[model samples]
Target: MHRVVVTGLGIKSPAGNSPAEAFATVLAGKSAAAHLPALLEAGVPVTFGCQVPDFDPDVYFPKHRRRHLDRPTQLGIAAATDALADAGTPDAGRPAGPGTAGSGTAGSGTAGSGTVRCGTYVGTGGANIGLTADFGALPHDKLPVATVPMIMPNTTAARISIRHGLQGPCLTFSCACASGSIAIGEAAMAIRYGRIDRALAGGVDSMLNPFAIASFARISALSRRNDAPQEASRPFDRDRDGFVMAEGAAFLVLEREDLALMRGARIYGEVTGFATGADASHIVQPLEDGSVAARTMLAALADARLRPEDIGHVNAHATATTYNDRAEARAISACFPAGSPPVTATKGVTGHLLGAGGAVEAVFALLCADAGLVPPTANFTGGPDADAIDVVHAAPREIERLPVVSNSFGFGGHDATLVLSPR
Candidate 1:
């Protein structure tokens, strides 16, 4: 395997559309959650959420293109475009063979030497299909028009490729909440294996519909903090209920270390290690043993050739749900015998973005590595059930030099952990 590094990043989160704003909000320990918009209705148990307050897709996409996309696809395209631009990825097209240097191939007859061969891997979930069914019936023509053009999981990546001139492989992964992280991990591998010179990896999801809320609420999966939206997602906190539904997208530009160096890219960090596993324990609940989770983390560390103590901080996949937080904490404690490193859950500020959660949080982890600071966890008060780990609160802490681990566990018992080292 070749060395992989993250050279560019783009995010459209609840806190802001840019990395600076998102990082500032994380450092301030502020909450982006708010009462659900009137369009969402009040019957939903979890009416409050961390939504992208004022994202105007028109700013990124033209009016003609914007009208055809849903919220999720729009966000994905926005982030992907920004990442490609940041990476200086030329719109030159794909390569023709295995060793061509053009478009990521080293083979002969590559797409074009001037252009970087690239692929896209996006993680998402079932979009607002019901909305499409409803609004799609507007009868503009005999055939029902799709209210949401990209309502399926794969469309998110497809639309991104269409928006940008990425002519390589376009793949999408839907492993529930872990979708985003897996997509990024796969993208990194694509570059590491010389499949493409550059890859765009991330997630986008907008599941704020009635059906989504009802389904989660029925399963007791959503936070019922209707009255107090900001205080809802309390990861590792005793009073934590369930995850708040949210929507957003985040993307990263991954490439081989030498290639990035040659391009003079400002590397945020290196994707040192990645591992994934399945619990096979339950459909939606994590296993008590946390065997798979621990294995995933350990495997990632092994790949990075770093000890548990080498990790200075952990970006927890704390959905604020009781079961999730406890399970993740236990896994961390088992992996790191030196009493879990200082932990922070950015989901406390950005409500669980479902498929997009892992992608958005991964960006935060990289930002932390680049800035040498760990953002505080918000909406948390002292509690007994909370993990017995140092939790940064209210203010950012300087963690100058060390590696970090970002974990993401999703439904279907999927678990993924990525180890990152400062560049």
Candidate 2:
């Protein structure tokens, strides 16, 4: 097995548009949760979310393509463009020698010598809201238009591939909230196993629709704290009720260690191990036994040649739900009995990005690892179950270590864990 490393990252979230801005906000313990204007006006159950403040797809895309794509696809495209540009992908038509100026290199000075061998993978919960909105704009008397292309889950990845001229392994993965992280993990595996030299991996979701809110409300999954929108997503807090659904996108560039080195890329971290499994217990509820999730973590550790004690921090899948927080806490405690390393949940700030949650949280894990600080679980007041673990609350905490685990546990018992180490 070869080594896989992250060369670049791009973030478009409620906190900010750029990765640096978002990372700084996370480290500062800032919360982007606010009363959602559109939802509140529409009388949705939940009134707030970590909605992107100034996101105008037109700023990133031209007028023509914007018409066909949805909000989720637009977010994915913007994020992917930033990631690929940051990775320094070379021109499409011309594949010249080592000294050419236009040669695509992986941020490093080394010119790409071999085939581009780039692939794309995206994870999304809701796809093509803009296209759907366009349909809604038409009068009822008008004939139903073929809006089929807009809402497909794979549309985001396909659009990304088309935009970048990537012809390899173009695929999309959806594992509920863990979709994004799983995509990154799988992309890394592809490169590590020599399937591709470079890959774009990330997730995007924009479900701020009335239909989505109504469905979640019916299921009692969304917080009904319309009074205190910011405090609604109180993960690990005793007062916490439910998760706040959010919309955003995050993407990262993964490349073979050798390829990254040859391109002189500025490495953020290495993807050491990734594992996924199912509880096979329940669809809505995770297994209380947690044997499968724990094993997944252990498997990742084994694959990375690290021990439970080697991990310094964890980017938890704490979704602010009562059962999930408890089950996840028990699993972590059981896996790392020796006072499991500092655990942090950023969803309190960004809300749950559904299919994009795992990927965005993975970015937080890498950023925290690089910055040497455990980001706080924003808006967490206090809780009995939370105090049992070293959950970072209120503010970021400095920590010492190189390796960290980012866990994403989704509905349908989907559990995925990825181990990352600083470059």
Candidate 3:
């Protein structure tokens, strides 16, 4: 089987717009959660969320073209474009075929003649819910003709394919929070099987509108600590009320190891393992036993030919929910020996990005491997169960070269894990 490696990363997150910026923000233990003026003015029960500030769509898409895309699609396209550029892939408009000069190499190289088939795979939790609500509010006569295309869940992947000239498989996964991780895992598998030479895979979700916020509020899934937005998303704190809603997108450029090496690409890390499964216990709540979640982690380790001790850090799918934090803690404890790897839950700073959580957290994991530093989990106030695992807080922790695991569990019992190793 061929090896898969990450060549580029692009992120538009609450922390920052680029990978460097976002990772720096995480290292600084900054909290992006803030009060949403729109939600507050509208009298929504959940008024605080982590939103991508100062995002100018015009910078990514022209005026006429922007009208056809919803917020998620726009974010996805921008992230994908950035990933491709970072990978040193040629522009989509260029006419370069297979084996052409400057096509296979990393810096300023084309996608290696047309023979190097490229693909796009992205995931989202809610596909344009905000746009759907807007269409519903508009009069029938005023409804736009492009409503269906804009509201479709596959629009993000489709737009990414069009923008990158990806002629291979183009797919979208909607496995709730695990959507992004699953997409990235499958993309790596495609390269391993020689189905595609390269791929743009990640997740995006933008549903911060009033209707979407209200829907989550009705379900009691959002944090209501309006007076202290920054401290609202306390992943493992006993006082944790619920998760804070957030919106963002993250994309990674995955290329076959041999291809990347041949093109002299700057490899971030090797995607050595990926595994996904379901709990088969609950639709909304994870099984308290955490047995199924443990299986996912073990499977990923087995796939990577690694042992529990080989993992130096864990990027947890800690959504700051009461049950999720407890269940995930149990799962981690079950996966490794007592007091093994240091774990960090990034949602404490970025809030919960829902479907985009897995992808964005995956990026954080890779960055950790690259920098040899484990970022602290912000807003972590000690509680009774705070010592469930070796939670990294207060400051960043440095380590030698070692594998890292990133876990993502979503609604419908969807569970995914990916193991990354520094190049």
Against the true structure, what is every candidate's RMSD?
3.0, 3.3, 2.7
Ranking by TM-score: 3, 2, 1
Model 2 TM-score relative to the real fold = 0.92
lDDT string, candidate 3, 162-229, tens digits: 77667678899999999999999999998898777788899999888899999988878888899999
Residue 290, candidate 2: C-alpha displacement in angstroms: 2.4
Q: State the displacement of the C-alpha of residue 79, model 1, in Å, after optimal TM-score superposition.
A: 1.0
CA-lDDT, candidates in order: 0.79, 0.80, 0.86
TM-score of 1: 0.92
- Best-to-worst order by lDDT is 3, 2, 1
Give per-residue CA lDDT, model 2, range 216-272, as digits (tens). Answer: 888788888887777788888888888988889988988878767766878889889
Top-TM-score structure, candidate number: 3
In terms of lDDT, model 3 sits at 0.86
Better lDDT candidate (2, 3) = 3
**lDDT score of residue 344 within candidate 2:** 91
lDDT for model 1 comes to: 0.79
